[model samples]
Target: MAANIVFTRIDNRLVHGQVGVTWTKAVNANLLLVANDEAASDPLMQKLMSTTAESSGAGIRFFTLQHTIDIISKAADRQHIFIVVKTPQDCEKLIAGGVPIKTVNVGNMHFAQGKTEITKKVYVDADDKKALLDIAHKGVDIYIQDYPGEKKTTVDDALLSKVQ
Candidate 1:
């Protein structure tokens, strides 16, 4: 059975204090899944994030893109999973891999040299824009909100046009 995905968010800083405590509590999620290729391959990152999640009273797991697709696909229905990815590209992959993601919350994408600010917490470059637009085209709802209580800025044509 597909995993009970209660929340899916794209935050560069995955499984941090805000996510592990605030969002997990907000969503009432039991599991926190960090679906990032770099984090999955690094033992130090996994350990650190695992410790954080445990401290927050939520079970945590780090998986690569393909591994996330494989594992989440077979997860039990009772496991309320909160998925966090670093980029929109990764979010797109999860949907393509049949993870059953319907809505994506854009939490934080830190400023980079080539990126432009979309919201106070969201900055996107060309590639990021393309991936996000593709995801939107596939009928997925995308919005930017830093925290659970904040207002969400929907990713629409007007939003995409502002990237350039």
Candidate 2:
């Protein structure tokens, strides 16, 4: 049985109001999978995510990066899943592990000292760009779009705009 993955997104915030509500509803995803090592090991974070999901009427689960690949690889046929990772590197890991990702949404990445602002809501450094480019090379379309209905800006366009 193969999982029906609606979308794979990278959001530093993980399962917050926008993702727990907006993106999940946009993809009509029953399962909100978070693949992050830090969050997976944190009980408080898990509890908070669970609470948020419950309030939003969405199912949520947290998995370590490798476990996420293992579990998602064997997901049931009827599972309508939406994957969220904290970094593009995580998305690359899943994709490389054969997650069958088609489009990757760049939701939010806050500005850091070493990171360049790619968009109002997204920031990245060299490693981040490399990971995103790697995902792109695997034939996955990478776009920066905070929410579902908002205009999507392709990674190429974002980079181009940065140079212009």
Candidate 3:
């Protein structure tokens, strides 16, 4: 059975306070799936994220890109999953690997060298834009929304133009 994916978000700072509490509550997700290769392999990160999720009364699992694809595909329907990845690239990969993601939320992409600021919180480079565009092409609804209460900005041509 397919996992009940309640929400999917791309936030570089995965599984933080806002995500652990606000977004989890908003989506009513019982599982917080941190789909990142680095986080999945690191013991310290796992421990920290586990503590955070426990505090929010949700179960958390850190998985690599491939692991996420494999596990989520076979997940039980009762698992209300809130998937969080660090980049659109990772999100795209998961979709390609058969995660059944219908919508994606661009929560945060911090400023960095060679990346243009598309929104106050979202910065994108050429690769980032391409990944997002690919996700959009795959029929996923991609939108910029830092917090659940904030206004949602669709990843339309206008928003993509800013980075181009």
Worst 10 residues of 3 by lDDT: 155-164
Pairs in steric clash, model 3: none
Best by the TM-score measure: 3
lDDT for model 2 comes to 0.85
lDDT of 2 by residue, 1-164 (tens): 56788988999989988888878887888888888999999999999888877766778889999998787768876778888899999999988887778999998989988888888999888888888888877778889998778998888634734431
Model 3 Cα lDDT, one tens digit per residue, 54-91: 88899999999999988787788888999999999999
The best candidate by lDDT is 3
Better of 1 and 3 by TM-score: 3
Question: Using Cα atoms with residue i matched to residue i, what is each candidate's TM-score against the true structure?
Answer: 0.95, 0.93, 0.96
Error of 1 at 107 (Å): 0.7
Which ranges in model 3 have alpha carbons more than 4 Å from their true place?
Answer: none
Q: Model 1, residue 128: what's the lDDT?
A: 95
RMSD of 1: 1.1
Task: Tell me the TM-score of model 3.
Answer: 0.96
